[model samples]
Target chain A: MIGRFLAGLKEDKRIWGQRVAGQGVVVPPVGYSETDGSAGGDWVEVKPTGVVTAVARVHRPIPHLHPCAEPFAFVLVKLDGADTALAHVVRDHLEQLRIGSRVEAVWAPDAERHGSIRDIACFRVIS
Target chain B: MSTSGPPKEPVKYVEKQLHLPYCYVAGDYKVRYLAALKDKTILGSKCSRTGKVFVPPIVASPESFAPCDELIPVADRGVVTTFCIVNIPVIGRSIELPYVAASVALDGADISIYALIQECAPADVRMGMRVEAVWKPDGERQGSHEDIIHFRPTGEPDAPLASFMHRL
Candidate 1:
């Protein structure tokens, strides 16, 4: 589930500091739930740098079932400025997966994006 | 039906395929069940209270709602409880046309598992027809239901309807 970052709402406004601090509850990276504007202000886009808060490896080769046909980990990443963890796949460096390992997103090309979470191909471990 | 002079297409149209990957964790019972498939052994979960056995081990007994952890090895041979012939081809279908997708109830099993009944004519697939698992090469086994490539006829007599009637 891609977060609908409301930070674009008047980026030049004076409340940028307060809006940047807005936190949203991402029930589970895949479940969609935008900031209700009650707990915090409109949730805005934050840097993708974060840590893998939870992880699990998939071992099935179901073609259309899940993305990773080869063995890969499904990690929950807690972005630096975000309040909740977002779920995404981590491949290549499976050994780097842990509760607090730093990571970043590797986005898909512009021609491949259909405005969905697939835009972000997969997460890569940095630390 | 459109009563208008002519049908017109919508102004905006777009096609998209949902290609998100999902990693699912098969729970305790499913883990052990699939693990047994690696060795080509069929395991059943027996409900201590009612004594009913399920081929795909259940977390708990359905009849008496008891904790069913005891794993019992069952026969690989069984009878087809029901089946549908694949006359039409579909995308992503690995199997060829005129195949039988039959639900086979293994011996001493209360529930049946769905699988393809092949190596014979689809027209020959009858309800209660005896069948057995055609496991993949031991080297290719990957701890999944796919380990059993497909089921084929055993050339045995069809089981009586009274035997699998309760299952259907």
Candidate 2:
């Protein structure tokens, strides 16, 4: 049901001119141009390795049920070459997460077509 | 967690129009008076020479200011100058049904007031139709647009469209 909701909001067409840093490559991602009148930006791809800049514990469960058990950690990950950090739920326990913890993006088996930040699964600890 | 009882009945719902209170402030003098409407009572300023009255009065007369202080009581009942049908539903409206909103020119006032048209059908409404204020009961007046319930057609003969043509 959640997947369907996300899929309904997804735009299949790519919006040119806006660039997003993905997997360490600065690629032309789906977004509008802030300067150029035309669509499409210089696309580049990057590695997915990132550092955990901040981490917070979630004591309460979200409205929807997750496949995992209760008491997970959420982390703000600063991917390389990206201006802003992406927020993703951390599956590790509260005691395990710390500043500077290296993590990597774990893609869903079938990339969830949700038009949301959760298209990618939780970032797992690299070590 | 699974519930032991049988499934509960789903709630039935429908969308309704929400009427929001709006102050129709027009003209320079009325703008100043409307600013004070929230606090004090202010009538239009009248020209002493022309004997013409301006509600929420203007500083200078459109023709010439005679420096008049003569303020007259304007009957709330006025004729509709112009109006449009609001068939599209707006989000967060307080009035439940689709209603006609109009610009009414109250008696003894030089200016027209924009307000909601009520108690009439969209087809029944026409320009220059006579309308009156459906005021809230005594002690319920808030001195705002909401104070007057939506104006209902007075069933009086429609005024000549030419009389209000210039104002439109």
Clash count for each candidate, listed in order shown: 2, 24
Model 2 CAPRI quality: incorrect
TM-score of chain A of each: 0.70, 0.58
**Which sections of candidate 2 miss by over 4 Å?**
A1-24, A31-48, A52-101, A105-115, A119-127, B1-74, B85-99, B108-111, B119-124, B142-144, B155-158
**Local distance difference test values of all predictions, in order:** 0.71, 0.59
Computed on C-alphas against the true complex, the DockQ of each candidate is: 0.03, 0.04
Q: Look at candidate 2 and tell me the lDDT of residue B143.
A: 52
TM-score for candidate 2: 0.46
- The reply for model 1, stretches above 4 Å from the true place, is A1-127, B1-11, B14-19
Query: In candidate 2, what are the lDDT values of residues A14-45, reduced to their tens digit?
Result: 11112423322222233333344344333323
lDDT of 1 by residue, A1-127 (tens): 1122211111211001113123443422222334443333333345667888898887775677677679888889887665677778887788767889999877666566443455567889999
Alpha carbon deviation, residue B114, candidate 1 (Å): 0.5
